[model samples]
Target: MSRHDYFSQFLHAVWHGESGHPLVASLLAQPAFAVYRNTIFKGCVDALSANYPAVRRLVGEQWFQGAALAYARRHMPDDACLIAYGDGFPDFLDSVDAVRELPYLPGVARLDRYWSESHLAADDAPLDTAGLHAVLASGRDVQLAPQAATRWHWEPAYPGYSIWNANRDPGAGPLSGLEWHGEGALLTRPEGQVQWQPIGLGACRFLDACRAGMGVAAAAGLAQAAEPGLDVAVMLGELVQAGAFTSFH
Candidate 1:
């Protein structure tokens, strides 16, 4: 094998402990090597910790660090930039048998990931009143901004949204009861900062339809279908003010 391949395999074995020592097994015995390995693990753990603060807060530092190290060992960093690391963490949480009792962990992690993604999304100008007016005059389909991100997760068994929100805001009071509700989160970069809003169920459908390239009327119809009493005009106005749409084509 090429030297590069050999080096890769050596480091892999070191990180995963899946095989015998690398070519320089004696070197691995050095205290410095141990420190290096630990540093790498710590870095990965730190990144995961930052990305999923809510998860860490929910699970406590010890449990979170353990899980983070295990996950890092199995799923090494694919990108040099750690900002987007742990993209698969929510799914990973679901697979962990230990966390099965806390089934809401995955959903909370998903929301945490959403926040990180939105925060790192490219800067863009949000659709404003004049843009909305132009779209209204054209009478065409609309699409979300490239930086806009929207997701919905609902579990009848758990209150994922409330858990996420409570943990996200430091001063929020502890949750009293586990009430289940469908939650919709929308993220957009407006004025160079990522802003997120918890939207209503009907509004979630509306955004979904709009993102799917539906015109205002059609999207509004979809929203109203989900919520019969929904006010399409008002909902559209609110979404526009929230900078949800980029342009109508």
Candidate 2:
């Protein structure tokens, strides 16, 4: 096999626990190779811990590390940027035997992923109230573009956003008295800091419409259709304040 092919198989063997691969069998037997393998495993576990702090917080260090190790064994990082690693972690949580009873764990992990993505997204100035008003004055046919750092998610079956919000902040008080219901979260980086807020289904649909490249009027219609009692004007003003829009044209 070519050197590249051998390297590829070596990586597969390391990640998948298949050390019997002929090309890597002798190397895997060396003591130093065991150290290198352990280092790789530690790096993956540490990166995953950082990427999903809320998960770590919810499950405690011991439990979280065990889960992270299992996940690392099945999936290796695709690139050098460890900050963006663990994209599949949320889904992986679903199949974990220990967390099968905790259905909300995956959703919380998803919000964690969204936070990381928003933090790394390219910078852009968000649309303020004045800019939104000017756009409305010009015409209603204009399309509003969501900010590059904008990320939103809706969980129709669980209060995932609420649970995530409670656990994300290290200094926050213990979560209590939460109403058990579906929730949606909207994340944006309007300035240097990432901001998040719980939103309703109407607002989530509105943002979805905007992301789909719909014009202002069409997006409003869709939002209102999803929520018959929705006040489009009020919702637009709230989103404008939240820096959901970047520009309109």
Candidate 3:
């Protein structure tokens, strides 16, 4: 086999815990190769731990590491950038037997993923009140684009945002007296740091409409339709202030 093909086979064998490959059979039998394989697994577990700190904090280190190892075995990083890894972690959590009792775990994982994505998103200036007014004054049909770092999620059944926000920090105190209800989370990187807040269903729908390339008026109407008596103007103002929009066209 070519050198490149040989190396690929070796890597596949080592990474997937397989020793049957003829090219890697001797290497897999070596003690040093076992150490190297373990190191690779550890690195993947570490990357997953860093990517899903909230999940790690929610579950203890021992449990999280075990889950991470299992997840790493089934799913390898697609690219060299480990920071962008674990995109399917939330879905993996959903299928885990241990996670069956914690239905909200997947949602929390998704929020953590969103936070990582926001942190890695490209820099862009968010729309300010003046820019919003200018767009309104133009009296032309335009669809507002969410900022590059803007990410929002709404869970219709679980208070995942509340759980995630409470456990996001290692030093955060124990959660108590939390009301079990649907919650929405909105994240934005207005400046350099990522910021997040609990949002309402109306706000979530509005952002969804904006993401779907609907005009401002149409987005507002969708929000109102989702939630009657919702103050679309107020919601719009709050979103603008939160730096959720990047531009309109």
Candidate 4:
């Protein structure tokens, strides 16, 4: 076999935990290779761990690591996997019927995955209306960019956020018995820090319009239409305060 092909196969097997054929002996003999494998494995676990701390906390570190390790070592990434991981975890969890009892587990994992992606997402300056003139000038045609920073979306089943947030901070809140009905939340980072909040159905529609590239005036109407009694001023303030809009001018 070609040397390049043989080496590539050997490395893939080492990282993926598949049978290495004859190259396993060479890989084990080299101290650097052993260290490299350990480092890569630990790094993967650490990244996965950060993305699913609540899952780890819920299932305990030992069991979580054991399961995570088994999965991480086995699965081949879909594409260029460096920028993102855990893409399959939600599906993986869903398939594990045994864990179906923890229905919220997959959802929580999904949120955690979202948080990680948002955190690592490309940084950008969120638009802001610091002056009254900019607000007036914006008139009604303004629209938020897809990259606009904003607080997290919140839904009825959002006790999971509280539960997840609690574990991140010290002695924050109760972790158990926080389950609720349906949940829909939005998390945006207007600044460097991430903020989360619950959104009403109408508000969701409004944001969806903006997210879909609708203009402010049009989005405003959409929100108001969704809920006739919607307080536009209040909703705007909440979105602004939560760091939703960017470049109001």
Candidate 5:
């Protein structure tokens, strides 16, 4: 390799901890560069931590950082000209054998990672049920956005969502009733905030129907089918209150 190319490779390695170069420690001593590197890693950790605060709290900051460091080290990423990384950390967490018992750990990471993307998504005005009632009044079939996701886990062990709900600081401790249970949710970045609204049985079934690529009318019918006594109007109200709708094509 040309001298310039070799130097560039070495620099990249040093930046990501891939190299055992003796100069690395000394270079890290330069307060400015160290701060820059720390910022880079901190950004990675913060994004991942925001999603995995429960894991971090459960494992402690030092342990979490150690994992993040090890993860960032292996996945140095080929795009050096890139602005950020850690896109692969979630899967990395899943692949590691040590954390196998943390079944919901990967899920938390996935949620956080998606939230990051949502934060960067195109701005959208979420659908409000006020208009939704009018839509139903108009009898038009509605559909959720491609960006939306929802589910009801019969097994409640995935407290991933609740952990995320708890503040970044672990002071609140695990969310009350920390054990997993049936949960319905709608995730969207309507109005520039990543909203994670927990849904009830009626709304959960309805949203799941919609998420399965079902039309609004069909999904609503399925929801009513499962919950025969569902108050369609009231359920729709609850959905609307949770920012259910967005602009139509």
Candidate 6:
């Protein structure tokens, strides 16, 4: 093998704790290699920990660090930059046995991922009230803002949104008895800060329809069908105020 190939193989073995490579003796003699390995592993651990603060908070520091390190070893970052490194960590959390009792952990991770994604999304101007009115006047289709993210997964099974919101603020005392219901989350970065609000099933469906390029009236119809007593106008007003749409055509 070429010198470069030999060096690469040596480093790979050191990383995975395999000491059988031909250059293992040489690498073992260098103390810096061990330091480099530990630093890389710790960096990955810290990145994943930051991305899933809610999960870390739910499952104490020691538990989180152990899990994070294992996860890093299994799934190294695909990119050089580690800012959005834990994109697949929610699924990883689901596969582990340690958190089997905490069924909401995966969903909390997913929500945290969404918050990071929205914060990194490209900046776009939200549609103003006049623009919204003009589109409604023209009776055309509407599209959701690039930053807007909506989900309808937290139902009777697990209160994902409630759990996340309660723990998002470190100082927000212990969560009281959860008001179990079909709660959804709508997230968007309006003024450089990612903000998420609890929404209803009808609102989520409406937003989904809008995402699919449905006209205002059709989307409203879908929302009303999902919830017979839904007030389309009111929901639209709330979404508009929340900066949910970029523009309507």
| Top of the candidates by lDDT | 3
Better of 1 and 3 by TM-score: 3
* Native-to-model Cα distance after best TM-score fit, residue 224 in candidate 6, in Å: 2.5
lDDT of 6 by residue, 63-178 (tens): 99998998888776778789999888999999998778998888888888888888777777667779768776776566644334333343446778889877776766788988
Instruction: Output the TM-score of candidate 4.
Output: 0.74
Q: List the residue pairs that clash in candidate 3.
A: none
> Which of candidates 4 and 6 is the stronger one according to lDDT?
6
Q: Determine the C-alpha RMSD for candidate 6 after optimal superposition of all C-alphas.
A: 2.7
Could you give candidate 3's per-residue lDDT for residues 1-249 as a string of tens digits?
Answer: 789988888878877767566758878878999899898889889999999988998889999999999988888778877988899999999999999888899999999999999999998866666866876878766788999999999998999888998889656577889889999999998778899998899999999999998998898888888889999778888888888988887
Give the least accurate 10-residue stretch of model 5, judged by summed lDDT: 146-155
Q: Local distance difference test, per candidate? A: 0.76, 0.86, 0.88, 0.67, 0.61, 0.77
List residue ranges in candidate 3 displaced over 4 A: 137-140, 170-172
Which segments of candidate 4 are over 4 A away from where they belong? 19-39, 76-84, 130-139, 146-159, 175-179, 217-229
Name the better of 1 and 2 by TM-score.
Answer: 2
lDDT (Cα) of model 1: 0.76
TM-score of 3: 0.94
At residue 172, what lDDT does model 1 achieve? Answer: 76
lDDT of 5 by residue, 1-249 (tens): 578866775667455644454455456556777677667666655655665555676667887888887776566545653333567877888888878767766666665565556565655555654665677688787775443422232214565556655643355565565655544445665455666655556666776766567777777788888768888778766665655555332
Candidate 2 segments whose C-alpha is farther than 4 A from its true place: 19-23
* TM-score of predicted structure 1: 0.86
Q: What is the lDDT of residue 142 in candidate 6?
A: 66
Winner of 4 and 5 under TM-score: 4
Ranking by lDDT: 3, 2, 6, 1, 4, 5
**TM-scores, in order shown?**
0.86, 0.93, 0.94, 0.74, 0.65, 0.86
Q: Name the lDDT value of residue 109 in candidate 1.
A: 94
Reference-based lDDT, residue 213, model 1? 71
Instruction: State the weakest 10-residue window (summed lDDT) of model 2.
Output: 12-21
On TM-score, the leading prediction is 3
Instruction: Note the clash tally of each candidate.
Output: 0, 0, 0, 18, 5, 0
